[model samples]
Target: MKNSSFIRKDIFGVPVLKSEILESFKDLSHGFSTRRGGESPAPYDSLNIGIAVGDLEENVKKNRNLISGISCSERSVYLTQVHGSEILVIKNDSSIPDPDTVKADGVITDCKDLALVIQTADCQAALLYDPVKKVAGAVHSGWRGNVFDILGRTVRKMAEVFDSDPSDIRASIGPSLGPCCAEFINFRTELPEALWAYGDEKCFFDFWEISRAQLQKAGLQADRISVSGLCTKCDKDSFFSYRGSKITGRMAGFICINN
Candidate 1:
């Protein structure tokens, strides 16, 4: 499967969805949204997918609809994204509740025609799919979530829920603040011990590396995984970055079924 790219513009004339990886999975619809599309104004600019970010509810709804159109899902399921390691199993009924009502960094679902969504600015957004089992999962992995191996946990949850095998799983690591731009302070405490446990001080803390390592540990083949090396903080025009702009809007990473 060769990697390709595509851009989907929001109704408001913003390039809301863009994908650099996972282009091979044309049967499945997925994209990473930008902040250029929507109805929000000022602080939120136009497209702010985050409802709790002080953006108006109506604008958030519109932005969501735009995303849903690109993903080809009726509606996208949002996660509370507490930066924790919690992984939740999602069913058809699971989409009814608001994101605030649920707490999880990752969610997995086998239900057809449902979209799995995750919000991120500087944090890593991971999308996983097992074509064989027809299972999908979305993960929001911030530094805290990475420390606890949330990606692996999510894959394990998928295995339990859909009897998915990691080897059959295809994964895409969406844009985020790359290691070159993702610096940390007070690393002694802010970061977990497992990071230093491997004795790679020169390596610093690369979320991409951590994510890839975790995915491999979960059994996904090296060829099945793709990483978007784009750094949100570095590419101001293409993505929204919390570290690049503290009060910036959030970008969404979504995966869904065409049915």
Candidate 2:
């Protein structure tokens, strides 16, 4: 029901956030990375997992490798996230290309040991796992994605592709721009009318609740979804925050089925 559902843990000197909601499933490997423990320098600081953010490609690769190693995934699929609702579904692990090749804001997969990575500086990464169908998905639901209902679309995609029931899906929203720091001055022009209700008079919006409501609307149970509620802008030292620092690195959210 709150961020208390997630815990911070150290993995090979790197700090990551793990949710208790998905911990009961031994066949699943999932975590949200902090901005610590990597090869990038300065603005990226250390654990910046996004290669398109001006960081050196070698540094990003090494950082991603560290994430893959700690996550126990064979390969981590990074995407060219454009903040849209396009969700890519992976059914095969063979012939996988290098990172940041795919163009999608979300990814669903039945392939084991292949981690779906959603890199974010302040956006929300919703991780989904349908243990019943052995399916896993990751969605980068930024403000634009919320307007498009990316998570809901991903859920329906899973149902269509993997025959996964939303009831059987367990979802988690990782650390992101919380309501406290998510101030949008032009909500009327930027956000949809329905989404306007989630904002305050001062313009700050509660995206966590927005994502939770979207998941429930997509047929997922409220109890099965966990929100980290950790604000990236507030905790800029731990996670990257573009709003806090425009020239910042991207932390990632990873999910995979154990081989």
Candidate 3:
């Protein structure tokens, strides 16, 4: 992600992509992880959080532990990420199901100090926060999720659960597939017709703009959104890319209501 006044590097040395907009909200904490800092080795390199991938179980454990320390939450909730529009709700109350058992593409939380995480390689890990309601959401938006409008659905899901209006929510689009590398040889069969306008000289689509349009369609103001335009495929040195390599580590995007 490119640096700007809206998004700045952390002085804490976590090597994360943070949003100045989200950072300004005292009650919340959120960041997108880069491949720079952690314990995984070689291909997993460092900070590989996806457990389902071929990475060692112990390596993933250590990586997750490092993330837990960064968020300062006891544990962060993650979904199975089915690439569907299903939304998992996490209440502030004490009782909640095991997050791993929640097979959904997105998570919504009104809970404090409980981190909500999204795992991704070449897909967008979109983060949403409502300062008015002190609610947050993290979504894994792959092309399939995009076809189903997962980001927009998650916004409305927060409204259903926490009474959060999109106008009151601020968002950050984490790095993922960019237009430069989102080449689709058969977009006519793979992507919907509505998204064809963003196609580049080749068949590559600009998913970043698609995300922005989806968020705006859900009622979030243009100024309230901050997009990290970094393309995971283009920046392999900083992030994991499934398209870049079949075997690669997964980076993370995190959100929580600070205690």
Top of the candidates by lDDT = 2
Q: lDDT values of the candidates? A: 0.78, 0.90, 0.86
TM-score of each: 0.88, 0.96, 0.96
User: What is candidate 3's TM-score against the reference?
Assistant: 0.96
Residue-level lDDT of model 2, residues 1-259, one tens digit each, is 1367998888988888999999789999899998988899989988998777899989998998999998898677888999877888788654665545667898898998888888898999889999999999999999999999999999999999999999999999899999999999999999989999999999999999999999999999999999998899998778899999999999989998998
Tens-place lDDT digits, model 3, residues 1-259? 5667336455346687788878888887788889878788889888899998888999999888878878878868978888888898878775667866778998888888888889999999989999998889999998888889999999999888899989999999888898889998888998899988888768888888989999999999998998888889988998899999879999889998888
**Clashing residue pairs for model 1:** none
RMSD of each: 3.3, 1.8, 1.5
In model 1, what lDDT does residue 113 have?
Answer: 79
* Candidate 1 accuracy as lDDT: 0.78
Model 1, 122-208: lDDT tens per residue?
898998888887788999998888788898998888888788988999888777878777666556788776675433455445778
Candidate number with the higher TM-score (1 or 2): 2
